[model samples]
Target: MGDLYSELLVKRERTAKDSLVKYGLIVLTALAVFAGLFITPLLLIAAIILGIACYFVIPKTDVEYEYLFINGDFDIDMVMAKTKRKRVKSFKLSDADLAAPLNSHRMDYYNGNQKMKVLDFSSGNPEHKRYGVITRLDGDTCKIILEPDEKLAQAMKNSAPSKVFLD
Candidate 1:
């Protein structure tokens, strides 16, 4: 039996394009200050305020993991390891299941029993095809990874209902 934790790879979801507005405001503000036009302090203050506001306004683009049960339906849980105080939420997933496929990776799954297995989608060898989470995605490719927290893994194992597809 392999160590469940070691067998999985988790990629945190993030967006490069989303930061454009945030960075743009900061850069524009800096440029204004350097120009030394009238009311530089006000411009600087406005920029700072805009930056602070943007911090909260910007949507959180954190990575999430998608787990599909044997029946084909799946669920998503936010990866909480990166946060100082972690929070976890499990929600039934539908069409938006795998938001990003290109960044999909392998993970580990335990069926409440002691036995552990690795979910490797990247294995070129088709004979050993293993089960794992595949982000049901559309539009853009979103990176997906396994949750690193042990508690989370245990929770997922426990909460996952048999026969996930209700219909």
Candidate 2:
């Protein structure tokens, strides 16, 4: 059979909390600049530096996550705003101990466990087709949540029918 391949691109969404934090930073920076005008020239310089720093830090990230599924192997990568891609995780379908919907009872144990490394690439909303993949690393279980396409899900199920669960 030919090699099966699929890719899923997930973009990060900004939430109400994120918007609040961003605006809070902006307001704080404006206040600093306003107050610095009366304090000293050095204070004004410091405010400008702080404003520049906030410009880079406060805004929501434009990072995109790419999920690559080739045959039985899976890889996750981060495509940054600078057009640079970095590998985030790599594993084979056979390596997964369990795969289930994020809201399923099968993930109860791993959900509350702090030792599980959670990698989330979902849309941050409940309606998405969110799934969790549980794997073992260094004797600890890790859970990764991602919104995968239907083709990718089917490919995973075909590759490891016993390990990957959709219901």
Candidate 3:
């Protein structure tokens, strides 16, 4: 569990840095465009407008974790900690008899008691791809971040099982 937490922290930091870089580039590009229109003041004015537009168009920052645990029963939680604001969603496993399959794609599980749902992390899902929950010997845990892909997102939307569990 400690290792997993550490890994998640590292990944979160890296993501923050990456987002900073991406936004920085957008701002820089906008400025460059404005500067290039030095001769035509109207073009510079247009560039400024475009820059402001781009800044607003950028996606909002979201740093969250989708975690899964398997004990005598399964537990799932989503942790979002940013700017000292914390949000959490937790649920328990519904199908005690069925073991979650091992795959490199996102999987959805439901909590029978709470009727809530959780999604396992996968490299192929942009939303849930950043963190992977791995179980180790002696009940230890590890969390890993993987590059983002679209396959998992498509699968989650298109291939997710209609009947999750027959309880």
Best by lDDT: 2
**Candidate 2 accuracy as TM-score:** 0.80
The 0-to-1 C-alpha lDDT of every candidate, in the order given, reads 0.37, 0.81, 0.36
Across 109-152, the per-residue lDDT of candidate 3 in tens digits comes to 32222432233333234554343323332233222223222433
* Steric collisions counted per model: 11, 0, 0
How far is each candidate from the true structure, as Cα RMSD in Å?
Answer: 12.3, 2.7, 13.0
Candidate 2 per-residue lDDT over residues 1-167, each given as its tens digit: 57788898887676787677777778877777887887766667767887887777564355678999998899998776646778988888798898889988988887898867887877677788799999875666788888888988888888889988888
- Candidate that scores best on TM-score: 2
| Candidate 1 local lDDT, 10-68, one digit each (tens) | 44434465467556656776666654456555666666666676565443334334343
Off by over 4 Å in 3: 1-90, 95-101, 104-167
Candidate 3, number of clashes = 0
Give every collision pair in model 3: none
Off by over 4 Å in 1: 1-9, 32-39, 54-88, 91-162, 165-167
lDDT of 2 at 137: 58
TM-scores of the candidates in the order shown: 0.34, 0.80, 0.29
